[model samples]
Target: MAKGKVAFVAHCLLNQNAKVAEFARLPGVVSPIIGKLREKDFIIEQLPCPEILAMGLTRWWTTRDIYDNPGYRRHCRNLAKFTADLIEDYYRRGFEIILVGLDGSPSSGVRYTGSSDPIWGGRPQATVDQYKIVPGKGIWIEELEKELQSRGIPFPRATGIPMDSQDFDMDKAVKEFEEFLGESSGVQG
Candidate 1:
């Protein structure tokens, strides 16, 4: 029997409706990336939206520092554990899996997670500018990484799909996915 290939994607990547207000870029899934993955015979699994699960859809836009609290961290950890366990099972079954995240997101950014230190650190309200993307994992991604490491499983490097209201670069996302697939194939070969 032929083993299946899978890609675990950020929830909002597959469903823009899951994103917070004013953040969704498309009416539905990120089509280009999804199309490429489908062409490659990848089974797409959309991860749960951590923020939506923890805080309702009406939740305010906050920084990672605010969500770095104990309660929210616990929620993320639990979600991570469940996701990791599922991935581990797939690994054992001879399936290939890749984790895909959203860049600049507070909960799922792979390489450039959003941070609002200056704003949340008691700066004046006027000085509180928009959150900036920095080099780091988001709250949920950090928990997922930790969970994967604890299970003695190699953490799959994440590919970031960037999306904003004004700019939705499907070509960039497709390129990223191609690079990721090439790297994974090279490793297996």
Candidate 2:
């Protein structure tokens, strides 16, 4: 069987300082899956929407930051709508696997909405003409990466991950990831 091609859809304006909070918002966005499908070749793309991430970061920022950026309020509204559209576009691409982590944006009842809580995440909403961000099992990124590495597939470098969230060493997050993707997987445990 041909190996699976996973395309990770990440938020734009990625910064390590905020990655921890971002990961906390959606814990298993990539890590767990990376650990599992070790043989799978993957292409992870940041959502490529700077306005959306900026808007979200605005909300997460301290009151001072919010106060500093008066346009922050408007950014949030426009960003919410932009995100919905962007997500729909990605979904329409018909990726075999699509992971959307709405880290900072809230549901406006327009685009697809996933839970802030990782445990109750993965909600698909109707937006695009045909595409739908359907709900599915939260992927085990670490295990997936481990499995992929064993297969010698190249894993995209993770730019922004939380520092203290996952069990694996934070500094080795990418290194371990590289190793994980080299491992092989057969038994579906």
Candidate 3:
């Protein structure tokens, strides 16, 4: 029998190549976090990268406001629906599931997302300095929750690694993730 435990992580968490230029912190997967999940015997499921799906790998660093358009929202909702179907299948099989998002991401942040000045746009020489961390779920996360809720599926608790902050602390993020993972080890829907 399978372990029946899984973690749904943002695509960039598993493949930094999916990130925008100059935004990738690791050469590949975030090994520390992935290692912890493996140590806990949880199967890792990488969620599709919304940004990459909508804009491609050559996309620029952007904020929530930049991506808060109808087309993008529709794209995210479609992806969420597809993902929720798999989640529901897992739930039906009595698998325990959790979500790991990238904090400060426009598409996958759980508790914190990116925002920017009203006049901000992707310029030829644009930098991340215009971006601001705001309190809210990212576009993709919000849509995922909605889709799951619509299907009467119990949404799993989610935690995010602070990848956007200038002062990100890996140890603290990992500790928090561990605590989140350890809580309510019982099987979930």
Candidate 4:
């Protein structure tokens, strides 16, 4: 039976192995969040990790400005167009589409992104304290939105998994997502 509901999520949410070495909070999947979506009967789809796709597994940690370039944006646009095609197909079929992003990812953040001082250019810093999480969409998310807009598809309801918090607040993340899901109950595809 088709439930006509789909949730597109950041890759690392389902596979922590895909994240940067020091950033993997879980051993594998984020069961709490994924379980909630499963309970709601929404089919989950993992979006491709733009950083891994573009820079390979050995890539170092960086800020949004580092990835905010023509080449990276073009690569993201291509990925977005492909994903948007899938999104359009589901939309055409009248499925409810929801987006879940990594809150501080340079490539996939939906509502808040990671940024650092303008002087961050050369070598990777000795520490990550200089990074700050601020309100904004990441490169890949922006490209995806633009791709969807060009195709005349309204952006889907989106929420972020807040990984930027110092302690990785799982409770807060779940609460926010639960609230978003509750609010989206009345939304129609």
Candidate 5:
């Protein structure tokens, strides 16, 4: 039997085409994609309801779905919790899952490009590209990877955090992410 359940960590950023496409395919994200992920394809998903006074209550009250706090501090925490919970839920069912989040930055009310959700508990991580854009500091991919490693879950080690400086080609991103996600699905143990 599969060791853990598969839950994708897809972030619906960019155009609908890209977001929906990634959700439909890709690896590391939630499963039940209609067709096969090309391992070289991409696309990215939505949100869920949370029970009050539950896990990370501080996060629940202070997180998203209520206020639009500054810097999206709350949203970040909630996202991390949500993402982690999603994965754990799947694992509980004996299916190894991966959360390949496709994060980006875009104004609110605009297309779902990225979220301000930071990775709580763990220190901030910044990619090379992030430094160039946001400057100062950023969230590193290693933090998440380490957490997953502790649980025997494969974490995403994407070199660059698809910052869109690459020109934001939805088609190319979808293809690459799809293939990457598919490649990992088989080893969900």
Candidate 6:
């Protein structure tokens, strides 16, 4: 059997339309990175949007603390299990799996996820500017990482593409994606 490369990407990376109101950086998919992934023979798997699943699209802007509740945590754990299962299956088949996440997101950020200094306790009343973006894992990403660790899945450490800026930089995102893939393959960017 021929083995294929696979990548698990955050949903917003593929569908900006699913992002919170006024938060979408691109009109459609994050084409630059997606284009490069396709060129690299990677079968991209778009992970489910945990926030969208838990709350509707029109849900108010929130921080990780708001989603830190038991219910939301359980939901994230279930989603993580499902994602891990797929990755494990691919790994067993001798396929390489790479995890990609959106930076500065409340659910999928890998490196610079958003968080509240003091717990917000609920959705923000003002705009997203009221909250701060910190260097940490988003709720779902945290759960996913834990799940992968528990399963003993030895995969490359996940890489993040910036998507927090009000004006998203496709060029930067593409460059980051290339650099990440290159590093994973022992090739310098």
Best candidate (score: TM-score): 4
Give the per-residue lDDT of model 4 (tens digit) for 61-167.
Answer: 87888899999999999899889988888887778889999998888899999888654678666367777887999999999999989988888889889786455
Write the residue-wise lDDT of candidate 3 on 44-144 in tens digits.
89999999888898887787887888899999999998899988888888888888999998889999998876546745555567678889989899899
Off by over 4 Å in 3: 1-3, 122-125
TM-score of each: 0.87, 0.31, 0.92, 0.94, 0.41, 0.88
By summed lDDT, the worst window of 10 consecutive residues in model 2 runs over 104-113
Structure candidate 4, residue pairs in collision: none
Clashing pairs in 3: none
Q: List residue ranges in candidate 4 displaced over 4 A.
A: 1-3, 185-189
How close to the true structure is residue 29 of candidate 4, measured as C-alpha lDDT? 98
Model 3 TM-score relative to the real fold: 0.92
Candidate that beats the other on lDDT, 5 or 6, i.e. the better one: 6
- Give the better candidate number (2 or 5) by lDDT: 5
lDDT of 1 at 159: 75
Model 6 TM-score (2 dp)? 0.88
Residue range with the least summed lDDT across 10 consecutive positions in model 5:
131-140
How far does residue 107 in candidate 6 sit from its true spot (Å)?
Answer: 0.8
- How accurate locally is residue 88 in candidate 2, as Cα lDDT from 0 to 100? 38
lDDT of 1: 0.76
User: Model 4 — TM-score against the truth?
Assistant: 0.94
Tens-digit lDDT string for candidate 2 (1-189): 313344444442233234423333333344453434444565454443333256444333121212223364444435434443443343345433434333222221112222232222134432222222223211222222334455443333222222222232444645644463455531121
Error of 5 at 159 (Å): 8.9
The number of the candidate with the highest lDDT is: 3
Off by over 4 Å in 2: 1-39, 48-74, 100-161, 164-168, 171-189
Please state the error at residue 162 of candidate 3 in Å.
Answer: 1.0
Candidate closer to the true structure by TM-score (higher is better), 1 or 3: 3
Residue 10 Cα positional deviation in candidate 6, in Å, after optimal superposition:
0.5
